[model samples]
Target chain A: MSRTLSNPPSVELLSAVSTFLINDIAPQVNGQSAFHIKVACNILNIVAREIENGADLNESVCEALSNILSDQKTGSDEAQDLQSLKAELSEVIKNDQIKNNAELLDALKMLTLKQLAIDNPKYSGYHQALKSNER
Target chain B: MNAPTDTLIDNSLSGYLERLQTCCRKHFGSQVEVQNLSKLSGGASAETRRFILSDPNKRSSSAVILRTSSIQQGAEFSTSISKDCEAQIQKLCRSKGVPVPEIYFCLEEDDQLGEGYAMSCVEGETIPPKILRKDQYATARENMTDQCAQILANIHKIKPNDTTISLEDQSPLIQLEKLEQLYRQYNQLSPIFELAFKFLYKNAPKKHEITLVHGDFRNGNLVVNEQGIKSVLDWELCHWGDPIEDLGWLCVNAWCFGSELPVGGFGSMDALLERYSYYSGQQVDLEQVKYWQLFGTLRWGIICLFQLNCFLTGLNRSLELAAIGRRVSEVEIDLINLMEAL
Candidate 1:
């Protein structure tokens, strides 16, 4: 975990590739190809962000899920994984098993914010959410 | 004028143009010519093209838009109406004084152009970013909210009985139910979506006056000129539902394109509601519109998933479609914000 590879990391490599596509290749192309290159650049950026923040975000989500499940007295004995916890939480919400739970709402908002941070930090709602969080 | 053999005019496009020329000749007389037929940026449901139709005898030429169903018929989830029906609805909406394009003719099966229609093209900018950022549209931006409100009022004024085409009437709860069903079909779990579904089901607005909803009415769909809105395009999603649905859809953050203004990045919600009330003569409910805004946000997220499913399932291997999957998180954040506000 300390140092598997030296010099440029995955994030740096992805960033370099995205930069190359957008700055170098984009202007050379036109129309649909140009548009797609931009999209490819964006996707690369997202992947880079995911690589950087995905583990921490998932850990935070798992912690939030654990907190919510325990608060609702619905925590399972099997030491559920992130996907299973999310599925359980979804079912809980779907069945209206939890009502007016401020903690649950906050956790969901945090989860969504963390996701937006990875997927598209530039999205207006993500920026707005971050601004509001500051207040 | 003969069709130009430019690089843009590929074999398939040339063949399409030839068939279109024959179709136009049948309607506009033997001397009618089709020129500058180029594909326009369009949604998955339809192929949109712009061309000039000229009548040599009359020495008259007109810009026209040809909107045809994708020949291969890709899975378009929201498009409930056929292209023929869409044309009929546009004609009906025009009769009701809605600012839509003038339909020239609906293509028959024999034309081999697939199901589609040709309409007189109204020139304007439809791109949201340009309209939102450009200084040329400053005055238009000021007036667009009012124009959108009035146009939506006019659109809602057209009663279901007035139109020959059948518009499916789905109440808010029913719409939510259908959306949930569609979301379940993909079998992807998002706790945010689940929470949204729960909130929507609990607080679903009671069905008020059902009217013709311009299902995709937003900043990007409106054709904006220097003066104001020239036309409303993309009627494929039009249906009978809560009239406020259109107003809420207009306010969706995705449509705002990073603008602070909730109403299509042009004006405030209060202004939109006031103008809508003035035009439609119906007092607007702020809560109802907010409900639909939240609903629209969730609906858009599900649509992103659907688009991703299309890519993942190998139905349409489009990078854009795959990229849309990332956009679902944008909607999720918007949904969270909307719910917190409510």
Candidate 2:
């Protein structure tokens, strides 16, 4: 898969920029401008992390969602893409067909955990969830 | 008085100050002076500015807050009531012995300061982290959960029949339906939101006696000091609904601001509920509160989504709103945790 280019370099560049903003630029600015700079750095950090982990993350999410859709009695037996699979899951949940089902809850937990892992890994709840699951 | 810097004083603020001076003359005297007119950092809903109004001849002065709706963040979401309506509600809440600031003047059309009112400024810390973590507020933090409960109980006592301000008497089920519709309007799908919507829809609380709910009853919104809560602020979302809605919103983990405490980063839910039942003379329903807690979390998450949508849709191009949109995932985490516990 390594041709003539790669993404890590770009992500590293973003990280460098975020580090510069946090260490150098933020301490100099004041008020709303400083706040915006901090948020910009945070957004950069999230984007960089996403670029690093997005593919594996999406694949795992698709697998979890597919597992939920294939539940025996209440599940849909269609082979579909990630978007359609997600749409189907949303429909069944919205229609109250799988409301509070144990399998649905598990699927939801996985999906949420995956989301937090990429979206906000440092969130205290995410860490707490990870800790509790470890035991 | 600190003089405003030449660079700091801009055109619109100068014009706004002139208009405020004109408005003040009617209450004070023709020679009324407004000093230290500066912006205060707070919520995006309203523009809060602090100033001192003095009449040298009378030798009297008062610190007042002049609040106006920001042209950018104007009521794009459904929850926000008009500033005039908020002023009316605050007046009624004050009359009924609720801990809210005193409204001094409601801006008229001739005043041209847009939609907002002036009120007596109550001094205290409104920043959530400062109250949650700072040593200066140690005593206040210890007593806050009880104070919040008493405040919520007092707020719930405001009768719909007594106030001229219109408050919506909608059921929790109806509110959930409205939220679903609003979520659809965003036209972006999140499996997390979908799952949350499903859970909340299936377990929406039954309607109780509809009373005034301080729609933003949480930590950062409370004005606290060494004594305790000074006043409850931000009535923009106040409405006539299930009073338990307020209790649930107060305990939402987002309002907890990363603190382990369930009630506004201050104390336990059991303590809050116990005090609320005692103060209001009604037994609390823990199950109903839990249902609303999930609803409130999703509701706050949807609000983050809406703020992001506002930025994306070019309605209000604000960095803060965009960053807040990123916080939806945080709520997703909280929602999952709450559901697992249930």
Candidate 3:
């Protein structure tokens, strides 16, 4: 069975990729040739989404990061703090160097804590929302 | 591929040898006989077919191994096999007496062989599981120190030649970039790997003497017997590059085969370095080797991921092959911790 979900690339590549996760991937999947086709198509779709909206996500992430850092400095944007921190994370991970050096290790550590997140059983939803415009 | 022919009559040695006999007579000349084609049952990377053979009018045959990518757990191919380049390296190593397999004849141009060649397979026990066993490896287990150091030193000592020199242009850094490019080409799923790549990039090593590196040199890849280290196998991953890559790979935990022994669970860091330095006329840098180990772990983890994808996604569904892919998470953890320790 294939999942067919699409999110606008610039606004929600993660969302688009995740929305169809059930459609694309099914764990406990046994020996089947179609399993190969599912993974190949899933990866292809993710890449297409990234290509379509990678720049927008990158730019918005950077802008959100700038706002978070600016608010932190002035003590004026506490409300946007957590949300922007998450956005800044998305941006930092977007930065290849930062991801490689500081963030990825941190993320893995965080992931160990959040393994099989109960809140989002789908598991790919955090990065999904980070990339999408609306729920 | 044709379901592997179910071995042969009585599941005996001659079944494989008979097939070899046919190959030799057809390819080499009359009197080409294949004998002692034994199955080297346990290999993490490839299903190794071990054997012996003789040339026409010769009383005895030389020892050799036929390496073919077998259907195994976590084994799948995304890139073209370099059996041809490996044969080329074996040809050179045999000339230099580097303790590597001696290549006699190869079917580099033939498609039926499915990426393999026949080499002067030195007599040895390549069983990693039994290396620590008291009974099976009593003799080879003892000289693990001297044999490992001596053979490793010999591999490092090989002189540069046309085939090796041509590969030097693709330096260690370039190779890393190429690996990253190849992985990314499949698609970027987890950003977790980006962290490892960034760490590698930031900690890139300065250029050094480009020697012929036995790309996958490690304890598991070495052939040992009652006498000691007979030869090193799997030059398929061979290339011209920093020799430290081999040294670093030797230290990887998975290759160590559950032994806490340094470099095949036989020697020490000092022993490995002392031997290498004594032969090369240069001081060995333990620190640089540390960096390469981190690189090694990351590269290995990614390769494992490729294996997992192959099976998990159904490109190849051999459960044994797919299991290797699942273990990538553990390697990823090891790598993260290792870098964190640094």
Candidate 4:
């Protein structure tokens, strides 16, 4: 604290920085900062980018996913049953995986992703990144 | 000084410029040239500015991109980045034919510049905000599904140690253990989500096979051009984990195109699955993809809480940051609804 007060950012310091760059540093840069602070700002932007707009992205997706899920699940009691199924699958996964049913969990995951995509149809990459019908 | 819990953070131009000058001098030699610390059109991880660096010999060099970590990247800096991992994996992935810029340097030590890296900047369109303008882009956007899958296959094909590369990441037991630890780290949550979390937590896959996971794969993270994908950017969250994590993340709701179609907002899920199946020679499992998709939204919701907490800790304050901190509600709703409908 004492050191900071003793050497505050005075007019001279600012001028010296500006002048030194204009004369000595500017010539070398032709005037540019290589690892620029814009880089730092960019870091902030990355954070800000997600912050400012991520929810809209989420809502748009959820609404979209809902539409798809309705289409694929295809029944009046489907949504209600999915909740029960999710729980049962969770139990089956936690309790035990018969070596014979090793492929079952994978099948569940495929179903979950498909269900998710149905709600958020824009998430087409689910299929793009998978095997065609293993689920 | 403002209250610590403020969400908005604004940068000082002078401070930015000084840091720029010093960073340049230290890295590029005495002739430090930093320009445009001013904001660029599109950025999500940190504030970015378009700028150039020149040599002492008067021969001009390619422009460089500087990236720093921001609170917006995620509330938990640790969550959004492992700079060491990012630097190493990027270099490795690029060598393995994954398209990305050639990183010049990653500064772990911040003598002058903050934490960031210098890379040869490649010009391409990644801004979802702008990419929608072209009719060609809209019509051909579906192609991104196959294109992205092919690139992911190239990445997946790179056998890090041979063993972990073949399997999808969800070894149910480990996933359950990790999620328990992770959820515990985020103190506040609704009871509904707690139940949902418990259900998913209990259900994680038991297979221990590992693979490369680009934890946040999505359309916004991809850079593209007329022909196809130019570069796949933002590698900080990548790790050795279930391959499904990346697959699920890629297909999440947020990156949809203008149309309501699924893959990158361009096509049907079935078509995307077919393309991936064609390339990988593996049977397509809709069920596994669905499981990952659910987990992806769940994970995203938890991550939003971490970001919101950053504001509480005074790491950064910006309206954008505040807004992001607020967005957790939507993801929470997504998680709850999905679990309910599951």
- DockQ metric for all predictions: 0.57, 0.44, 0.05, 0.03
B174 in model 1: Cα distance from truth in Å? 1.8
Model 1, stretches more than 4 Å misplaced? A1-6, B1-10, B41-43
Q: How do the residues B1-342 of candidate 1 rate in per-residue lDDT, one tens digit apiece?
A: 001112254246447778999999999899999998877744567877889999989999999988988755578777558998899999988988989999999999899888999998998888788899899999999999999999999999977777667878878888898899999888678888998888889988765887888898998778899988999988988888889899989999988888999999999999999999999999999999999999898998898889889988999887788788888889888988888889
lDDT for each residue of candidate 3 in A1-135, tens digit (9 for 90 to 100)? 123355343335554554555455545343343444344444444445445544454455445445534533433444443335544444454463242344445445444223212112222223332233233
List model 4 lDDT by residue over B61-170, tens digit each: 55777666543443343344545456667777788788888887776566455567777777766756345457656634746778777767666665558432233333
lDDT of model 2, residue B10: 28
Chain A TM-score for each candidate, in the given order?
0.86, 0.81, 0.35, 0.30
What lDDT would candidate 4 get against the real structure?
Answer: 0.54
Model 2 off-target regions past 4 Å? A1-8, A72-82, B1-10, B41-45, B58-60, B73-75
Weakest 10 consecutive residues of candidate 4 chain B by summed lDDT = B1-10
Question: For every model in order, what is the iRMS?
Answer: 5.3, 5.2, 10.9, 12.8
What's the number of clashes in each of the models?
A: 0, 0, 14, 77
Residue-level lDDT of model 3, residues B309-340, one tens digit each, is: 66666767764454454345445555655666
iRMS, model 3 (angstroms):
10.9
lDDT of 3 at B273: 78
lDDT of each residue in A39-82, candidate 2, tens digit only: 78778877877777777777788887777766623665666767
